[model samples]
Target: MAPKEEATNAKNVATQHSQEEQLLHQLPKPNIQNSKYTKRAVLKTLLNRDDGGFALVGERVVVGGWVKSSKETRVPIFRSFLKLFGVGGGGNGGKDSPLSFGQRVQQQPVFSTVTLQVSDGSCVASLQVIVDSTLAPPGRIMPSGTCILVEGVIQQATTSGKHTIELKAEKVLHLGVVEDHEKYPLSKKRLPLHTLRNWAHFRPRTTTVASMARIRHELTHGTHTFFQNNGFLYVQVPIITTTDSDEFSNKFQVTTLLSNKATEEETSTKASGVSLESIKASLKEKINRIEELKRTDSNREALLAAVQDHKKTNELALELEAEEKREKAKANALIKPDRLNFLDDFFSCQAFLTVSGRLHLESYACALGNVYSFGPRFKASTSQSTRHVSEMWTVEAEMAFAELEEAMNCATDLLKHLCKWVMQHCHEDMKFVLKRVDQNIALRLQSVQSTEFEKISYYKAIDVLKQVKDKNFTTNVEWGVPLTEEHESYLADEVYKKPVIIYDHPKEVKPFYVRQNDDGKTVAAFDVIVPKVGAVIRGSQNEERIKMLNIRIEEQGLSKDQYEWYLDLRRYGTAKHAGFSLNFDLVVLMATGISDIRDVIPFQRSFGKINN
Candidate 1:
């Protein structure tokens, strides 16, 4: 090819590239963070602008955020002059722009300005803000965590940096100065997650926690989308329920009994000033006086008068004693009528924070055909493990006219949908997690979404565990025993390298609600164990036979009277139903590759650990 022809082709390529850039800026963009309700543009909107915020130059906008870092710099006189004229450096335009280059110099000895990196927790990116010291003092807005709302014009960055555009503050609309910079919890550059947990109220400002928040929001949205699209009604179950859904009994009892008892005890203490013993002593003294009168051969009238006084004192003592007994009885009324009775409680019956919503959701599914409940469930477990939190959100779904196979399919589909949703919609946060939390998080999620999970029975799983000649598990495997976390990890992480569904667990280990298998030794229950996080989902086919359910309830030593309402569904119109419950926190843990379940939640409530 000749030189002229080659040059012409290069010129055409350059022209095409220029046109594409122009078209990119002209395309319609999403209204992500800028809205009339917001009254200002968020950092996410400016940072994630379609044209990398370059087209936003010369546009005046208001922004509010906390200062992540602040620096004051001095500029030379010649550079200042060039910036004022908008000739040498990058500026929005000429004098029409809102001080795009720098602020007009006054009587100050040196040309100084403060540049702040501000973030609003909307996204991981922070906007660079240039504020003239005259509008807001450097000392006031210099510290990290100092909040400010400012009106500024977007301008091309004077110096090349991560951000394409910078905000030139024309007016400081609001300034929330940090009083004690040294004492601020977020002032430090880096803090461990455990340390941040202590300052949970302010931890959202951190990049890790902020990213986790976005991940959680997207996961929650994805959950609702999956269920709603699959014709599942979003039914709400009671958080404080009258019966325990599981046999563990690790339930936080919701009652006013303790307070009521305290109040009654206080009233009883205040009611009686004199002791029963003191009254008896007074009666005895009066009787002794009567006896002395009689022994000394005093007048009959005097002796009779003394005897009458003694009788009156004895009657007073008896009245006092009776009042004390009544007070004791009133105090005893606050105690349980029997072992499980809570008659004196606020609800007049035993109530606890629900451990699972499957039972309640089953009732809804029986009527609604398909239903789901998503809310926080509480456990009074004392385990201080990273995975065990006192409060965790669970997503439980029940399907009517469905068996164990359908339930397993539903669980698998839901997990896959969530994984794909997070990968697509929460790309930014997932990237952050990949960088900070786990290196292989994206790959793990993709594998889970695409791979077909392996299913095995309880006996098979036990056999596989026992056959592992090279690996020794902490908990020994047995035929009728529940699989521990160690055993689950080996199956998912070592053997399959993916999720595994273990079904037909031993009846002795499962709850009474599970349908008894034909063998009579195992129940139609399944647990979905994933790598890193074991048993994220637990599901089973419910027992539809009233007699079998009653016997199981009795076998577990649970009161049939308490579960009579649950039995009514089977007695009236029984239908085979199956359901599964997924721990939302555990799902998040798997998605983000965060080892500790506590970190995934906004404010985790764990054993002996509760903070704001």
Candidate 2:
């Protein structure tokens, strides 16, 4: 070798060595999983071949998973010789697909061979399990969605690109019996996303649902970690509340009027002094008196009268017992409707499932400095659109003495954090989603991480919309008019081709709690909009001045008493604060490339549909 060439090669070797040393010090390297290392094995670890390969052939491992699809490819008695060539054992089975190993040996109608696709929940991919019918039978049929535990040896790779390592089943350790194959909701054929929504409970067993579920979970954990690591306290806001800080949205009311009559009956029964224990005691005492009368002092006339008295006591006790039974049945049932006044209901005036934890979170923020509430939120909207759901999860945070720009910065950081976390941890799931669901999800996530979100005031957004008169918009773009989803989508997807953050919205368009800017027309508010979904987050600096809050409440036609506590929060403290709420499921939907909001939530409650 030439002298200069040898020196260059040596330098390259040294650079590679330095990189390896730094990586080792950063974290302990993962052990290569191959044959003979079988205490426990995960799907990702087994399928991963890049990091020095995994799932050694001939390793005996116990794998538990829900069956995605199971097929019994019976090789005809005549084609039995084809097994010698390994035709039907673990090939992809599709002869027509471009990537198939070869033309699949046609299965004969005579002999039985079973192959199962199982997901271990370790990642988005499935583990090919080659089941030998003679060794471990799958009953009459191995239905899709059945859970099974199989102790098997990870042997030879399958011809299919879908699975890297195939497990040769030694025994069918446990096979969950599917009561009726015909009635099972999940079948072998691919079901539409909407159809999957109908079977949320069992949908997770499928690859799409399972992958989306893990992605959502990782996003949630990542979000919590970001805040927790950044010196933020995780505070839980109440689910049932009487306060509606944002008066703009309708609340899902909780009233006792339905069970009012039953409740009243119960109350009257208690007031009338009917206790089961008291009744039982009285019955026993009367019987004892009768027994004493018969045994000790039995004058004929007195004995007769005592017997009559006992009969009368029996009737009265029976009637009381019947009344008690009736009351209990009524009270236990859902409340029946009645003309109940607001003050006479269960919670008294009014109560509801919280629309947002922002208002309550603020109280904690004032005391704790920086705090956040991440929990499910409810809405009573009857709309059946893709964006609207009766119930969803949200993360709302409050920063004391913060402004619109600071809130926007935090939001940008959070979005980037979430994107990076998903890319790093949910790589397989993202790849699966990109292949099966939305093709644009990768770009959406990349835009958040690599590109800067365009920041523009509400006025500036209006100006941009007005300039684009060539394209007719469904929603009017006039100043002071509310910008709908259509408007936001256009600005992000069409105009800027990126995420757009719009702040300083019109005062009338914003809630009463949003701080009014000095201009008196716009409020200190901002919304984060992405390409596909218009606005994912909305936040604002609160109306800190007690007098200003009161005035805004009155001007907005809000009840004075409803916000008394919220007003007290401002009245009692300096209360200059800002907060924003991002829908957790929405984030998952955006990140996973899921088009419908319904598919993202595990159990979605939307419009007139809520399946238990």
Candidate 3:
């Protein structure tokens, strides 16, 4: 072969070699940091409760999770046995070695390992997965929060005096890739809970929010368990009702119905009189529509004159017009209140989303003896405080033949059950929230669980407020007047330093259903005031006396006829019973030490804002 032919063959071989090398570069390139690798690691075995990781040395496993942290660094990789001779390289080329100095240097930053706390929805706590750099190059490191699948060997993470457990990755599969890693929202830096609230849709990815969510689930489960274990029956109450439960807050009107079928009375219309001229005009209109003409009325005046020539038909037309006007007037007269009665409006009388389920619970309690309703309760309160929300969950329980002390015992037991449940089941989450959000969370929970609440009368609370020497009271502490938030907070937070149960409030200050004391000045009522939250719960040994109930109803200025069903409970088979409502969100916030009640609920609906 000629020299030219040989050169051509060499060029073809070189091209093939170049392509192979490019393909080889696509595989995982190892760095000094992540030289050890396991193809896969079993998440369940690794993050299991008893046995942490399942991978014995030199075992292969698959690991799949989201990236938590990623970093790149360079480490010197020594080459050539001749380096033992203490020979050094020059600027570009080595002085005595075969390779150049530039060739010895790694082109990109070296990556060692990536940490991912992965969860497959099986558990609350995520498994910490440390992935070594063998499967990913510097450019290949996925961004924080990027989902990934990997194949690796389970081994001790580092060979040199390192005891940490990690996977030695052989290959990494990008299940979903983030092209740009720098702009990821979450970072190693601590974020404020308020800032996390702004990104509520993605806040659960955060540790604090995730912990709160778990704690919330536990609380819900604990509540259901507590009610179910007790003899109390869970009952469903009407969300939309005609009667207001508590008259203090306004109710949202319910204007829509499920089976919104149109009624014949609404849909029916008067049938047209069979007029020969109208039939002919209708046929012509249909014809005109099909033809799509601009106008065929060149002889409209002549047509009108021809019709007017018949005096009998003209008289009939005038009679029809007068009859139509009379019919229209009759229809309009039938619609007295609304324009045609709003066309099957489904709203004849006023109805609203209920403020409380206690009234319904009372009816159920009268029938079932012991019953409770736990569901979303709505209110139209305009207060813009952190404790106030448009919608809230309430646990309203009623028991027959029970006094206020029994009610208080039930409240204390229920609260203790929740605290114990959190301590046993949600310990991890409780720890996270207590450390990050509020350090006093543990103490608060224990205080509610272990300690007996301070019992004081409403009059006593006022006296205590008057006696305060250190802090000046913002609100007036007068008898027979309603207590403000500032007044209640001082009693619970500063004066008592524990939960204060203030009972026997003024009859006018309390609801109409509260039992009137013998003196007729105070009622058998109680308010559970906590330190952080002013009033978390309220209850009363409801008025069981018919004549006294009537007097109280009159005093509250409520119509007696409207509350006859509630008043009937007093009239027939009256039992000395009491109940209370626990604001579910406030309870969680109080337990977790979160200042804002909004943080405890998933989607908060406030006076002016509704969020997803």
List lDDT for all candidates, in order.
0.86, 0.80, 0.70
Please provide, for model 2 over 1-612, each residue's C-alpha lDDT reduced to its tens digit, 9 standing for 90 to 100: 999999999999899768855654565434534335644466677775563223265567777777777778765554565556554456454665422432343443456667888887777778888887776556633777677778887755555465556888888777777788788888748888899888878888878888888998899899999999988899999999987766777777787675656655654546887675776677788788778878886788887887787687677778777887887777666542354477877777778899989989988988998888899999988877677699989999999988778788888899889989998988888888888887878877987899989999999999999999679898778999978888898999999998999999999998888999999999999999988766889899988899888999889898889888888887676757898998787788779877789988899998789888
For model 1, residues 368-468, the per-residue Cα lDDT tens digits are 99999899999888887767689999999999999999999999999999999999988777878888889999999999999999999989999889999
Over 517-536, each residue of candidate 3 has an lDDT whose tens digit, in order, gives 88879988888888888788
Runs with alpha carbons beyond 4 Å of true place in candidate 3:
1-51, 54-66, 72-126, 130-141, 149-164, 167-188, 256-344, 559-561
Report the CA-based lDDT of candidate 3 relative to the real structure. Answer: 0.70
| lDDT, residue 310, model 1 | 80
Among all windows of 10 consecutive residues in model 1, the one with the lowest summed lDDT is: 98-107
Lowest lDDT sum, 10 consecutive residues, model 3, at 259-268
TM-score of each: 0.80, 0.75, 0.69
C-alpha displacement of 330 in model 2, angstroms? Answer: 15
Task: Name the top TM-score candidate.
Answer: 1
